[model samples]
Target: MIALTLRQRNIIEYLLSRDSYVTNDVIASNFEVSNRTVRKDLEVISAYLKEQGISLVRKPGKGVWIEDKQEVLFDDLSCSYSKNERIVIYVTSLLLNDVNTFMTLASNCGVSKQTVINDLNTIEKFLDGYHLSLIKNQGVGTSLEGDETDIRRLFIDLLFTNDHSKIVYELCINNDGIQRNLDVSFELITVIENEFRFRYVDRDRISIVLSFLLNRLGLMKTKNSTIQSSDMERINSILSTKISDSNDQEYISSFLLGERVEGSLTLDSKVEDEANEISEHLISSLKKIHYFDSEDMKDIIRSLTVHVRAAIYRCRNNIHIRNELDEQVRFAIGVMYEFTKKELNVYETKYNLNFDQSEISYIALYLASIFETGVQEDLKVVIMIVCTFGLATSSILKSRMYQIFGDCFIVGPYSIEEAEKYLESHEVDLIISTNYMSVKSTNVIYINPLLKQNDIEMIRNTLFQESFMKMCSLFFNKNKVVEHDYHCLGEYISKNDVSISKGKISWEDAIRKAAAPLVAKGDIENKYVNTMIQAVNEFGTYMVITPKVAYVHAGKDDGVNKNCVSLLLLENEIPFGSFNTKPVIAIVVLGICDKEESQLLNIANILDIPENIELLKNSKNIESILSLHD
Candidate 1:
């Protein structure tokens, strides 16, 4: 007698289960084994069948099939085996002779007896292996020790490895008589089955799968087929009844209308019709909502529609729902409704929102914070004009400083004692003192506050310019002014107006007489043009007023012109005008009169102020002088 290996027996069983033929590739792919292994098994099965006088035929790509069967030698092995050997042999024998039971045996061999019993309990796989009777005799325990080969073969013939294929075949037979039945495509059926399979194990996966298949088919056919609105209403009425019968009103409400129903109703034909009508309406509504431009909203609608539809289908199919499932559905619906409301509100306010003052203030504060954090880096300085008393002179001096510095410096007035007390702790760069008050320990640079414009300009230019010769000259010049109260001749022209001499006078004498009062006040001194040149060289430019330039302007002009003298001197000129004719006067006031300083030379040139003559010489009275100044 020839013995068949377990794999060879599997190949034979595999071929026996097929009505037509079995392919080697199919066997290999199914078993996840090499093709050579499958072929070797097939060769062994073919040789074993041949020895038994059974013919096995191969038809190349078509596959191998059993051609003929003959009576085999070991058809009755009972005579050669005892009962105990038979039981052990029967189990092992069943394992070697069949594919399904072989799988069970291989699975249970290494596990505990409890596991084997569990395997035995699965009726389908347990009875699949051999031609034997399963007898359970209470105290005797379960046994599969009786002979029944033909019955087993018949049973095996009815089964297939792929369960889905078996289901499709059964469905085709059951629904054959129904007219206009749904045409099920393989891919569509598989997709619907897989989509809800794991998610809904307790419910009928096959029924839900079929419903989706029918729905897909209907939707495809209805794509271009238009039904009138009235017909749609009738169709919806029919569907709503079906929908109602399938699910409770409250459960159905969360899905179709995004609201809850208050009461329950009987699941009669009328309720079925109402349910169907509602479902139809829901499907239409979902279709319309699915095409919404926003993807998020579309997903929301689709999810709710699917939930409601599934509930109705399950209800119609007599499926039960757990409390947990119902609660989850309710929670999902509530969340979606809230989200939809928020989205709608957002859309409503998009075109109407307005920014207010608080918003602007917040923005300004944010920008200020950024600046304070090193976004902008520049120092802003302020100068305080302090007199013993805060009176007109203090105000006048502050105004003068502001006129020169303008936005470049912050200026204010305070009393001397107030300034001294404040300066004790406050920061200041420079202090101009009009009185004899002392600052014994402060670091501030001090100067005479009663000084002329030339002295102020000299101090300013010296502080700014770094040239050695200019610094030495500035020091010597400052000392001379401090020691002798020496002021530039340009100050004489600035103070005195153009006057007609009462007696005959030479040009030099007339100049001296015009300049006499300022000289008496210790304001006018020699080398005035040199002082103005130093101011111009240090500060880039300076103003000038000659006896001639001033006199001529004083005589010819009134109002603002009387107080304003001629301004002269180019950027490169050095001592360009005489003391008696020093056209250039005070340095272009630093930081102050920026705009006026920018146009001062241009305006002076336009007014015909000259460099070599007293332009204000013809002024007759102080009124004319004040008028010219104004």
Candidate 2:
């Protein structure tokens, strides 16, 4: 019997049902997949049908179809087991059969012995991640041997990756098993969450960790769990199944600490140093390539630093997130991603992180986030006015200089020697002097010692164009001043996000509804909303930023797949916190990813004014919200 993937089987069934040919576009559209994927599926289906003496016919412009196929039906043809499923069979069989060989394993999986060998070769690579090796005993068939901690983490991760694999693994534990305390794991997690005041990202993974821990407890003697005594007391209370003797307790604690984003475990202080060094290097390297020297780079660096810390922690623990932007980021910004990956090579060995493809995707995206927000402002001219004149004359000259050179810097009346010393150290754009200073610089403007109008005109004529380029050197450093929409912070809010209340709803519900549009649009992940509520729970109603409006958000790390903002208007008031007298009638949920919180102050501007709040309530239009910007 030929094995087919789920998609391959689906394609065969679709073709068999259709009397006429289905075009690639039609198949792609119907399946909600790309045309390229449809083509690949057809190729697989064609090979399978060829073995069974049937043809899958296709024309480039026309379509694809299976002609006169009566022997094959969906029910008769079984979907092939996935690789993870095959792994479950292999590992579970090894655990069950005392003297199982490749031929025996092949018989169990219903695949060729040669196929089993190939699968083992691939599975070996995966076990390498856990530092576990597939060892073939001289007499016994095969077994996994490595550190007990790695073994526990490996089983937990396998269960997390595929639920189907769990049933097979459970068979090894059913007899003389800890099935009586299966629910104890659930209770433990709940206790830990409430006791610790943090939510684990993958509850399912944690449950599997606890279950595996129970199955392996007392099977062998191991080292201490390495978990703190204080934290382990809570675990011991939940699972008094002699868990004290087991090291699985610490792995569970470690898993809990690693999975949660907000209450992340305190890593070595060097982690922060490494993240900062990497961020600075990326910034420096990017500047060299003309990627950006823009003002947004500062925000980019800060957010990237935060992400790098989390990525390093995840990498060290062998936790991996499948970055959605992995393919697109690599495709669009391959050069930048390559540069970032190269810069990170220095830390890989020290941290034991290869900078996996997904982590690199996010890092590259942050580097790409460095962009020009607006036109670069003119350069500021830092002027050092050299004055050999008296104090009263210097004060007059300073005041006069300020009045005349409105946009340029005015540094004093240094003695000729003082001016020369200052010129060597500081980056002065222009130098104004009343006396002939023995300066070798070209920007020195010699002026009359006495107060004269021509001196002012000469200053203007000599550096008028340069003075126009001057901005406040203290605050705006020429290219540092990013052009902002000073009048309105309305760029992010639009009609797609604005929603009127169907009726009055709970503040929590209102936030979910406000953010639901973004969730549905994939602008944010489903976890983003839960994190928002968690934020409000952890902190108070500081989310309620204004009188009748509330702006709520969690850090971008909590599950913001993209950056977005949404607004919900309520006809009735809902109290966000202790502000009963001033109940919030509007809610705004901000979803951000690997970026700065750039939208809050602007959204708050809308809520700050009474008229704008009224506009949001009365019109309930996106344009109304957009117009409320300062």
Candidate 3:
């Protein structure tokens, strides 16, 4: 089936949502896109609808509307959407298949050959980042040229891209190499859960099941195939006649045990000696940073030992488990996440690997449990679940919700009438329903009853906003809120502007140049610059906050004239010692004469956004940079 782009799907939904036909110009303005872009999106949408035996009528003045409204068709398009995701999945499928010609791939993906070629170029770049390559021979067609483990890693990554569970289940049931008669993937998942005696998270289960199916498809293999006597016995009890091959049993058992043998997979070792060794290092590193307490030493060690063991295995094999909570974790945890990431770098470098956001998030998840109560305690937003399909489904969803959200919500499953009555008497922060209900509430969010990852993300984002608002209300005066320290980037730049460094410079020289702006602005004396340089020379470039951005600041005691901030965009990337791979593209200097007037935290928060950092780097003038604040 042809997948629609997010914009195309959104356009269709917009048209469907409205009774009257809206003009193209209106939509273009609404979406902040050119009229040409809107027209093109509509054309794609209209063509897609036409293929489904529906007509999208367009009147020049009145705009566009569907002739026969088909919510089911639109819903299907929405479900199977996302252009980048489709391209990634299509390229992955082509890489695994026998035929790899652009024509054949395009035909399979239901796109033009040119589009397939373009996607291949994008795929090539993506593979390069993973230290893999896409090679196209004169007659042998195209292939993914990479280490066997990396190839398998790519497969798992692609499989878990969009609507992972739904897509994986279909792949397992329909793939020619896998058994079509039985739901082998689902059954294997159940067997693993039973043998392991621990429930895998929804996404993790999908990844595991898909990995098995991919193995059955002869595209991948499990690393370790060593099955213990006890594990083998348990597997036999669970599978019995379900799995016939002894090798298959061993392979599945090894995967469950998390032993690294070959294919990209997480290895779990229960060896107490190794566990103690890893736990000792983990605890020691965390203690040096004072990230956690020694009170729960045994439990922390045990938990982290297992986790780190699996993580080391994953790193060695290049298997990265996607963390759905990565963005939320980073946004909420902020400096804590950064600190955790930095501390974990010791292990990462030892393993000769770079930890993805997902892996860092796992670490944050560990620490957040320790120090999160202060922020997380009062953030529970009451959630009412409305699902007509019995209590079993609701109970399952409730359990999953709690698993993902922790104590962030007070969720209750309610019938439609029960929900209405409850809402009438009590306050509900949000309503999560399978089907659209005519509820007079602005906080109603429609989600799949199955609780898909995308649905979870949508719900998470909503709750995040709600929690942020609640936090703000609690801290700030509701009516007379404190204003932002600075109006915009332009204002900051104009007030405390610095010259961009010319030519390549040392990290020390760069800081000196960066501080010149503060000195010129009279924000700080020349002594402050010397203090910052000396501090960096002594302690190193810990001021390098995010990628391409660094904040250079010394304590008010060091040397300070007033509380102000200045920006310095470097013409060339400057390496700051052996700190990190990230080059210092923009240097934000802080002058803190007094701690009370310092907006260092707010400045860091603003620059934390990657796009804004890009703006700061690329801006020819302050006016251009300020445009981003809009």
Give the TM-scores of the predictions, in the order they appear: 0.17, 0.41, 0.46
The local distance difference test score of model 3 is 0.59
Q: How many clashes in each candidate?
A: 59, 2, 5
For each candidate in the order shown, give its overall lDDT on alpha carbons: 0.35, 0.62, 0.59
- Write the residue-wise lDDT of candidate 2 on 1-630 in tens digits: 667876678778888888776776566546645455777778778888888788888764357778768877667666776777777777655543434688877876667889898898777886787788888876667777777666765565454443454456454345233355557777777777776665666575456556666666664455434334444556556555446654555555545544533342233346357767777776776565444554655655666776776666566556555354564344334334545666677667565666676787788777655622222233446788888778888888888788877666667678878877777778776788888766543357777665464456446644533432221121122212232445443676767888888765777788888998898898888787887765554333445435566667665457777778888888776766421112678888777553333455445544565666677667655676666654
Identify the runs in model 1 with alpha carbons over 4 angstroms from their true place.
1-23, 26-37, 55-630
Off-target runs (Cα >4 Å) in candidate 2 are: 10-40, 44-73, 80-89, 92-104, 112-142, 153-182, 193-202, 218-242, 260-310, 315-332, 342-357, 365-630
| Number of the predicted model whose lDDT against the real structure is largest | 2
lDDT agreement of model 1 with the native: 0.35
- Local accuracy of candidate 1 as per-residue lDDT tens digits, 1-630: 545644455566667677886665466545544455677767767777877678888885457887653343344211222222223432433322222243333332333345444545453343544445555455434445433322322222222112122332343334322112233323333333343232223223233323332322222211221222332333234335433321222222221121111222212334344333443343343233222233434433333333333344333322322222221111112112222222223322442322221221222222222222221113233445555534766666666666665533433455567777787777653455555556643223334344444435433532231122222222223323333342333432343433334543333333344444433444334233233333322222112221112221111111121123322222221222222122222122111111122223222222232321232334444433323320
- In angstroms, the error of model 2 at 16 is 9.2
| Residue 476's lDDT in candidate 3 | 24
Give stretches of model 3 more than 4 Å off.
1-86, 100-104, 117-150, 161-174, 179-182, 203-306, 346-354, 374-630
The digit string of per-residue lDDT tens for model 3 on 312-412 reads 54554445565655644544453445556655766555646555666667766765454434345555677778887787898888888888877565557
- Per-model root-mean-square deviation over C-alphas: 45.1, 28.3, 16.5
In model 1, what lDDT does residue 532 have?
31
